[model samples]
Target: MHSAIDAATLRAYRDTHYRVRGDTPMTLRIDQPSPALAALHQVHGVDCSAFITAANPHSRRCGDDANARRQLALAQDLERMGLAAMAAAGEHPSNGWPAEPSFLVPGLSLHDARMLGEKYGQNAVVWSGADAVPRLVLLR
Candidate 1:
């Protein structure tokens, strides 16, 4: 089995690079707004206030088709900004733990993320968050 990352190491990296919002940690802030947000707003017509404020926010609550589409749009916008992305997996079939794949940017000092992706059998490192963290896309 692959060695698990130490909590301290993970905590230190997150504390230095991410902001904690409620229970979820926020990473990858958008330096500028993108047109995808506008398109999402027009298409969905739902209150995407949280997304607007957070920019390229990661949502783990995408439990339906519509929510999945919204998450994809947000992830695509982040990719357009030239940020790193990963095709995160959902729960493993054998174990209930998260099997999500992820990768850090070229210089983020988080080698553990890439290693974790490898451990989970997701070897592709791409530039779309949908590939990394969206539940619906992961199922597909």
Candidate 2:
């Protein structure tokens, strides 16, 4: 089962609490879902949807070297779904995001981050929350 959180609430929190700065890539740690891995279900959740719908400009502030990539891969495996499914569920590319989150200050590499999808066909990695529950970030 999946729960929902208001996208507006998340957006306000991001704007007031997680504003990004500079060109250095930033990392947003969104939590994974409960019970078991549920990428699709998680994406459909309110918080995840808010991030997916949020704006992304510049589109080069989010990525992962190898550790972040590997971590996300593990999460993907736990979800048991392909990139396409995740993208469809979240309404974005499954490869990853195209930029760092606008809400957070740049230069923070969160190992807990995950590559949810690629935006506009770019090699970007969307950051996830660190909480145990599922979460998403609105990166730009």
TM-score of model number 2: 0.20
Candidate 2 lDDT over residue span 1-140, tens digit each:
22143454344333332222333222223343333223322434422221221133123233445324533454444345322212211222233433332222012123322233332222223343333232443332
In order, the Cα lDDT scores of the candidates are: 0.29, 0.30
Return the clash pairs for model 1, or none: 86-132, 87-131, 87-132, 88-101, 88-131, 88-132, 89-100, 89-101
Residue lDDT tens for model 1, 4-32 = 44444233222221121322223432233
lDDT of 1 at 91: 24
Q: Lowest summed-lDDT stretch of 10 residues in model 2? A: 83-92
Question: Over the full model, what C-alpha lDDT does candidate 1 score relative to the true structure?
Answer: 0.29
Measured over all alpha carbons after superposition, the RMSD of each candidate to the real structure, in angstroms, is: 16.5, 14.9
Alpha-carbon TM-score of each model against the true structure = 0.24, 0.20
RMSD of 1: 16.5
